[model samples]
Target: MTKDPTLKPYQLRQLMCNSAQDICSKGYDEESGWGIVDLHGAMEQLEANYGEQLPFNDVAMDAYYVNAVNWALKNGITGGSTSTTFSPDMTCTRGQTVTFLWRAMGCPEPRISANPFADVVENDYFCKAVLWAVERGVTSGTSDTTFSPNAVCSEVQIITFLWRGLNCPDALGRSELAAGLGEHYYTDAVAWADTNGFFSVTQSSFNPMGEGIRAKIVTYLYQSLGRRQL
Candidate 1:
């Protein structure tokens, strides 16, 4: 059977808002001081105003933001300050993002064996968590030899990590993935992501080369945890 076209922008926004509300109701209280800014609004405005400026920005907020924040808040993936601000626009560092995902997955904290990166000292708090991610194959850093813990993670990086962490199965074949992905290092990542219904290349190309925005990362994580409804 032929598939229907993707949901319109408004419909996607409603889905996100509903999802966010459900998540907030599920014991994930909005912090007191931080402004619980409407990610839906931010996402919508970002798309309506900046669609042509960026690739990922073209997707509707409803399609992505509510789900992302819902999952992040519910799973303790992101803890807002007393002010209740999520700081969604702030660029996420590799260490910070990985820790959030680790906590969300209920992964245990293991002892650090050694500092793999020359720049990351053993005494660093993120050292063990970073090591855990590496050992688990959730992340492999920029290269075989370097972790780049301080680097700001992009939208693609975080989504790929989420996909790996969830152990989503791969797509049936190379043709199932978007064209040109066969040559990407994240070919398996995209294939697995698509097969699992986490996303679609037809609706929006995975853009694996792009950086992950905070809202998008949160949405993918929430979906990975199977908590999109709440």
Candidate 2:
């Protein structure tokens, strides 16, 4: 491409965002502001961070989670529901979230010998993920004998999983949207996630018990990766 090539509106938006990430506060969310930038910086930083566009039948070019899906695909975190479909709106399961996080962390081997949950068989797909999560304090199963991997994951559940995956860091601050939050095990996790811009579906309110669909889960994982400095 030429140095002074023109860009469409969506292309321009992506370029500007990726460029802002180049100069913004370290691991800070977008509300921190983009600071000052020029077309030169934007040009140089184009696609350097977000990577090239991907081919997903279910994901749109301008969807908020496009970057997340693309990044997840590139990093071997997911391969979509099929060769050309992502099934972004599918309800995410506890097993799927654990698997995604496990893959994002490079599919490391768990440090345990015996399987704790009868439901999480060694031959199952999420068995290793459950084990790895257990070793890291990310989860302790749904019960003494059941991992309940098939359970539908809620927004609070996924956020708590991610928070625990990061060793439960203290929130530097809380979002104003967190004012009326009810007392629950996930209250602190939601606060931390809100502070870091995890829940992108709504800014005015949060449904703590809402279903954690696939799109939201991937976006949260992507944002978590950014907070981890890549």
Candidate 3:
């Protein structure tokens, strides 16, 4: 198109006005430089792209545990402590902890081995998991022949068990761990767990003998899986 050589001021103004109007389309206005803003439309489009959003009522959406809980759910690591409640604050027993790791590892059958522990009955749910752990050198027992299945496992014990289950990978350095975990048998395990992302960096002074809750244990297991992509 060519401009008229003798275009009048009024005509020129009209042309300019039309040109400016052409810059905007249906969904925006002059202020927005397109058409009208359609927030509802945008939201609907997003829902369509991402699928319908479902709410897990019991899990706190903004809590630090929400991500780990959700990841565990998605990966079949757990279905929560109950259908709707995770019982995050509840302390996990030794049997439950082993079972969690066993389940996460795909519940492999243990090689033929004698069940030396009297407390771990053959008919119990955790029996096979415990035997599997023992056969793989993941755990020994509470004692020579007593697997304290009901006892609350310590953080160090749990981390050590997991480390053994993962084939005992080398941890890089441990000057801080040595200082904090004086004479603690599971110090190396804690260092390994921390180095492999099982424990966060802020946990410098680890209470190795302290009881770990369900939420924290599951979070540790989930993070450990992330390190090796299991």
lDDT string for model 3 (112-190, tens) is 5689999998889899999999898888887998989999988777888887887777786664664576666676777
Which pairs of residues collide in model 3?
Answer: 27-35, 27-36, 28-34, 28-35, 28-36, 29-35
What is candidate 3's local distance difference test score? Answer: 0.65
lDDT computed for candidate 1: 0.57
Tell me, by lDDT, which candidate is best: 2
Instruction: For each candidate in the order shown, give its overall lDDT on alpha carbons.
Output: 0.57, 0.74, 0.65
Better of 2 and 3 by lDDT: 2
For model 1, how does the per-residue alpha-carbon lDDT over 1-230 read when each residue is reduced to its tens digit? 01214544433443343334332223222332112436665465445533232123323445546545644554456755333455555677898778877766554565557655776667875676788788778887677667788898866677677767656455656546545565665667666566655664124566566665565566566554453222
Deviation from truth (RMSD, Å), model 2? 7.4
TM-scores, all candidates, are 0.59, 0.75, 0.69
- The C-alpha stretches of model 2 lying farther than 4 A from their native spots are 1-51, 201-205
What C-alpha lDDT, on a 0 to 100 scale, does residue 146 get in candidate 2?
Answer: 88
Kindly report the root-mean-square deviation of model 1 from the true structure over all alpha carbons. Answer: 10.7
- Model 2 per-residue lDDT tens digits across residues 1-230: 35435543444553454445434444223434434445777766664644456777789887878877876876678888988889988898889889988876657688896897988888888999999998989888888888899899987888899889877888869666555676778888888888876755333346888888888887887776655521
